[model samples]
Each structure stands twice: as structure tokens, then as C-alpha cells.
Target: MERDPPLVLDIDGTLTRPEGWGIDPRLFDPLLEWEAPVVIATGKAFPYPVALCHFAGIPELVVAENGGAVYTGDDVFFTADRDAAEAVAREYEAAGYSLGWGPEDTVNRWRETEIAVQHDQPVEPLREIADGYGLEVVDTGYAYHVKDPAPNKGDGVRTIAEHTNLDLEEAVAVGDSENDVSTFEVVGRSFAVGNADDAARGAADEVLEDVHADATLGVIERVRSA
Candidate 1:
């Protein structure tokens, strides 16, 4: 039985359904009440799910923008690898791919590859670049994202652990998409919930068949079992 700290979980498709449907409050309740910290590592913009965390009473670190943006309740840590995101975004745009909401520096995205392009970008061209990078490109049917090198979930997990003063070997992360693979590989324990993609489920130590499962509840059971 290993006793380790719990750190973060992906929100869309991992915890609740991507659209915020069929979520069991019990699933989130434990995470909110847990002695260990449980954060949300998602591809959503800073505010959308950040607001969800607020409503759920979650105070753990938030790894958003696929890792480009890391938020702790009191502070937000933007990525340091500005060059990669900007370069990536630039390459995609030059290929005639339009982007979604971000690229604040516009150059940061072309330089560091820190942002996910879905809100304002089309899916086809985004998929083309995702393939070009040898990175994982994910389409939640709502958004298209680029998380090949930097500013990914795994990177976000590391940043979160550092911010919380938690040990990497003490944390657990679970996700359900290809974008989650990087973050999934960085944690001590990784699990794929029932609703996850095959790549994600294969990446985890456990594969759950409980679609519509509660991420917090699945984790609570793991706590007891572990």
C-alpha cells in the first residue's frame, strides 16, 4: 500500500463529460474535501473551467491552456517557453490555419506552442499541424488543440507540484485524451476514467469502464485501495 499525495485531474472527459453533463457531485465532493490537493489540468481557457472549480469549491492548482497557463488560487503562472508556442502557432497560421482565442503576444504562440487553438480555429488545419509536430492533437468535438512539446499537461503537473511544494513521486493524475498523455506520464500514479480515449486508457495504470464516472470518486476509491 503506497501512501502518496493526490495532485490533479483533467476536467473535460476525465472528471465530468466535456459539456459539463452527468457529473456526480459526490465525485467532486471528495476532491473538494480531500486532505490531499486535487487540481484540474484542462485545455479550457483560463476562465471557463476555472469558474467551474470555483463553483465546485476546488482550491487545488489549475493547469489550463494545455499547460500554457498554470493557476493556483492566488496566483497564475504563465509558461516560460514563449518561443516554442509562438513558433508553433506561426507555423500553423502560415499553413493557412486560423487560430482560436489566444496568442496574447501572438508571438508567444508562434514561439513556444503554449496555446490550444479551437475556439477560433478550424479543426482540419489544426489537425494537420498536430500531425506535423509528432504531438498529440485532440478534438473534444468542441475544440482543437496543439500540445506537442511545451505547455502540456505533464508540464503543468510538474509546475503545479512545484508550486504546491508537493513531491512528484507523491502525486497522481488521470486524463482521458491524447493531450493528457504528457501529464499522465509525469505523475506517480495515473488512471484513465471510463469515458477516456484509447490512447489515454492505455497510458494509465488502470482503465475504468465507468463512463459518466466521477473522477473524484474514482480517486477516492483508489485512496482507500492504495
Candidate 2:
């Protein structure tokens, strides 16, 4: 029997390419038509994906700030479970580490725009942050993303499951970056887009290939079949 539908998705290369920060209708509108909850999961801040969700017409939930915050209807939830992150932040900053988010341990957030304490930083330091934190780092050739562990997309999936009462294993998660690897922990079907990072491709349940280079469509078709 088919399981419950996917309730979460990762942004950036998963749905939209770094060059195209906006929603790509050719890929995601169909997924939106599936009538399933599409929670935005990314290292970006709360309002970051809010605009994307608005653009995509996704009226579900969002796990933002790389699992640091969540947005649901009228309220915004920020987690204190960031202790590990806090530790990483202090050490990273003191080490003079460069972060995707900022000069220090800050997050550069945006949705059709950018916001941050200090948005510009060198890439080498960002990589160092990723290496030091055991996390994934995505640099869109413009922005920086310090993603959580192999449970990033997983945590986002679990968050969606919490409110929907859906079985964790039945959910699906998709992405095209090392950050997406974390999502594999929570879903039965974890997919990597054709353009996904090596770690993501290595860890996914399947890799969307052939003419289905479009990862969003890959996800939509999978749901339709389910």
C-alpha cells in the first residue's frame, strides 16, 4: 500500500537553482497540485522561505534557520536545542572561521532579498565551518549555507510528521546538497536531484536521473504514483 504523502521539502538546489532563487514553475507547480503539505526546510531564516511558500502557494508549515526556527500560521517558533550550534558558533567565530551566513556565526537570511549582520565572507572559512561542525555547507556562488547533520531534512520531515500524525518512515524528502543528507534519517524515500551534491547523491534512496533531471518533478511524479 502507498504510504502517507511527503510533507516536507528542501529549497535551494532541490527546487530552485542557485542562479534562480525564485520558484521554477516548470518543476514545483505540479508538486503543489498534489494537495500535500509542503514544508520549507532550509538553512535560511523563517521569513526566507515564507516568501517562497507564498510564491509557491504552499499553506503548510516551515522548518527554517537550519532547524533553529519554525513558522506555523500566526506564530513563529525558535528552538533552544541550538546548544550544539551555539557551541559551534562560538568556536567557529573564535577560530576566525568563515561561515556561509556571516563574518561571525550569524545567518544571512532572505526571500527575494538578503539580510544579515555581515553578508560577505571568504569561501575557505565557510568550508572550514562545515568541516568543523560536521555539517554540510552550501555556497550558491553567492550565499552560504551551514546545514545541520544527516538529520536536517530528517528533522524537517519529523516536524511535519508531528503535526500531521504521519508515520516518519512514510514521508519523502528531497534535495540536491550535502545538507539534504540529514533528511534521509526520517523518510522512506529520500531523493537527490540530478544536480545534487555528492553526499546527497550517495545517501539518497534514489537519484533522479535521465530526462527527469528535474528533482521537483521527480518528487511530484513519485507522489502521484503513490
Candidate 3:
């Protein structure tokens, strides 16, 4: 018998608009009814994704902080050097960057394995500073994520597949920004929503015409056919 691969989704421009403030209500039932494991992977902090999953009434696992960590219900799999991240954050602050933490926690406590900062501030200089410490900086929508690049969204999805006993090659990944590029590289079926950034669209196997949740639904329909 053929088994269904997990559905890995990216939030922000993929699930909701910058103005929507939440996952599209239209997706709730489809998500709750899906048989395969559903995973919400985002550059957002742990608490927000955790709360969103809870509200959606789905058993989807969450890979937060651009794959710097994985959260399954209350259990967490964090894999970053906090000491290194803190040092870098301090350096950026010293260089005159005003940083804002993610929605639920302070910059220092946003994620166990990564530092999340508001993207409205400068990041190129921060990236230069981060490189000296062997860390990579990624811009995920409205936030900048500083973490070990090895464990990215792709790795997060891979971990979820292993945890759920699904085949990596059968999985579907959808997103709309540079941060999702890593995920596009690793998933079998990779899609970039119409609103995706240029880099994200370039990295995807297919770019959907519809935007946001509509694009996500398009991916699901295509996957259902595959």
C-alpha cells in the first residue's frame, strides 16, 4: 500500500498575509482532516507556532526558528550554541543595531538554538559580524534568524519525517521566502507561493500562481494527484 508523505508548510506569506495576523481560517478544517503528518515550519518563535497548532486542532509538528529546533507538542529538540548566539547578538548591539525579539520572547530567549531579530533593522552588517563567529544569518519575512546553517528548515523537515516514519522523497514542502530555500532544496515536492521572494521562487521546483493560503491549497491539490 502506498503511504502519504508529510505536508510541510511555511507560515507568514504562505499561511497568512502580513495583515491577516493568523493562519487562514479556510485552512483549518483541511489541516485537521489531513491524514498524513502535517508540520508547520517557520522562522517564528516556538510559542506562536505552538499556539497556532493548538488552535488549528491538528497534530502537526512545528519546526521553528528556521529549523534551529523542532517542537512536537511539549517536547523540544533544540540544537544551537546559545553562548555563541548571545555573543553575536551583543556584538550587533554594540555595532548600533536595534534588535526586536520575536512575538513571544526576548531576543535572548526566543529559541533554544537560534537568535530571532526583527528584520526592519540592518542585517548585512550583522551578517558580517555573525560570519566571524561561524554563524549564518537568514531573513525570514519580518525577522532575521542567526543560527548554525547546517540545521535548517530542510533538516527540520527531515527530522520530522524520521520521527513520523515517512519517506523524505515523498514529502511536500511549501513556502514563500528566502528562508524556505533550504526547505525547497531538501523536500521531494517543493513549491513557492506566488508572493514568494525572488530567491525562493528560483529555488522551488514549481511556483504557484495563487498567493498565500490559496497557493498552499494549490500545492495540496497537486500533491494529491501525485
Candidate 4:
């Protein structure tokens, strides 16, 4: 059998149901114990995914802040234009939407490349504002991220693949949201969890019937068997 490719997983809707860090410890135990190159790709900022990796015993690199930062061990590399992101955040704040920049609650505050805000607020206006700054507003099912359009989960996966000496053709990506669509485009194979949004399902190569972690577990088994 061919060697299993690197597996890239989105944290929010793919690892667990969409909520704030609502993952069950047991859900990822098997993945953590597996001897393979695994990465946590999330729209969340640094230290959040970093902290999760530590807690989950996942020792590989992390793609955080919606592909703005790639965390490899103790070092982190940025991939977005920070000044543009800052301007976008300021624009939101000036428009009466709180920036959500607190260190404790605002994971985006810790990010270097992207600004994440509560998606519950008005989005099209924010998108218009972000577009003015040559940025795109991505709704990651958990938050609205103002970022450079080019850097996404796909770019993050490419970074991890290069860093780990793996080919992009030898990778599988699993996700369940609109932001994950970029990831679906970059990998050789993409699996959309049953709970995935329409855009995500449309972008994926295969759509699994199970939802959330269940779908992720099934993908893992498929990869192992392949």
C-alpha cells in the first residue's frame, strides 16, 4: 500500500461541533496516538490552536488564524499583511462593531495576519469594508475573519507539506465550512463532513454522511485502509 499522506483537519466543525472550543478530549485521542503527520488547521488565532495541540498531544505543526500564521514547534511564521488586517479591524470598530481584541476572549488579537470578529454581527457591510482594504471577509462558521484572500487553509496545508517534506499530492484535507473550501481546493483529496455547509460540500471530492468528529473518524479509517 502507498504511504498515507499527511492529514489536515479543521478544528471547529470538523473536529467537533461548531462552538467555542467544545471538543471532547476523547474525540481526538485516537488521532493524537496515531503515528502520522497531522496538523490542526483552524480559523482561530495563535496560542488557541497551540494550546489545543499541547492538550491533545498533537506534536505536528499548526495552521492558525485562518492561515495567517503557521506554528511549527516554538516558531511561528506569518503569511498575511498585518497592516491591512489592522486597518480592517479598525474599520469594523469605527462602524460600531466591537473588534473583540481582548487577549482572553479575542483569539484574533493574538493573530499576526488575520483579524477575527464575532460573525453574529452584520457581515456584508464588513465585507464591503474589508474589500475596500483589498481584503476578504471569511465566515468560518465560528467567526468572521478579515484577511488577505490568498492565504487560506489551502496555503496553510501547503506550508505544512513543504515543512514536513510531503507532496501536496499525498495529502487529504477534511473540513465542514465555507472557509475550508480553500483547503478542499489545495489537497489531493478532500472530505466534507455530513454537517458541512453547501459550499464546503460542493468543493469537496467526497462527502461523508457522518457529522463532525464521527465523519472525521471515518475519514481517518479510510486513509488508513488506502
Clash totals for all candidate models: 20, 4, 0, 0
Greater-TM-score candidate between 1 and 4: 4
lDDT of each: 0.66, 0.60, 0.79, 0.79
In candidate 1, what are the lDDT values of residues 115-188, reduced to their tens digit?
Answer: 55664566666656656655555664346665555457788778777777667777777777777788778878
Full-model lDDT, candidate 2: 0.60
Candidate 2: tens digits of C-alpha lDDT, residues 1-226: 5543755677766666435455566755665575556667775666767877777676747777556566655455555244444445456667774444433433442321112222376556555655776655555323564545443445655666676655666667777666567776667777777777678789988888721226666566767645
Encode model 3's per-residue lDDT on 1-226: one tens digit a residue: 5555678899899888535356777888878877787889998776768888888988749998888778764467876656676778889988877666544546446467777677788889889988999999887676787788677887877777667765667778999999898888877888998888898999999998899988887777666633
Poorest lDDT segment (10 consecutive residues) of candidate 1: 105-114
Compared to the true structure, candidate 4 yields what TM-score?
0.88
lDDT-wise, the better of 1 and 2 is 1
Q: Rank the candidates by TM-score, best first.
A: 4, 3, 1, 2
- Estimate the TM-score of every prediction: 0.71, 0.68, 0.87, 0.88
Best candidate, TM-score? 4
- For candidate 2, the 10 contiguous residues with the lowest summed lDDT are 109-118
Q: Which window of ten consecutive residues has the lowest lDDT sum in model 4?
A: 17-26
Better of 2 and 4 by TM-score: 4
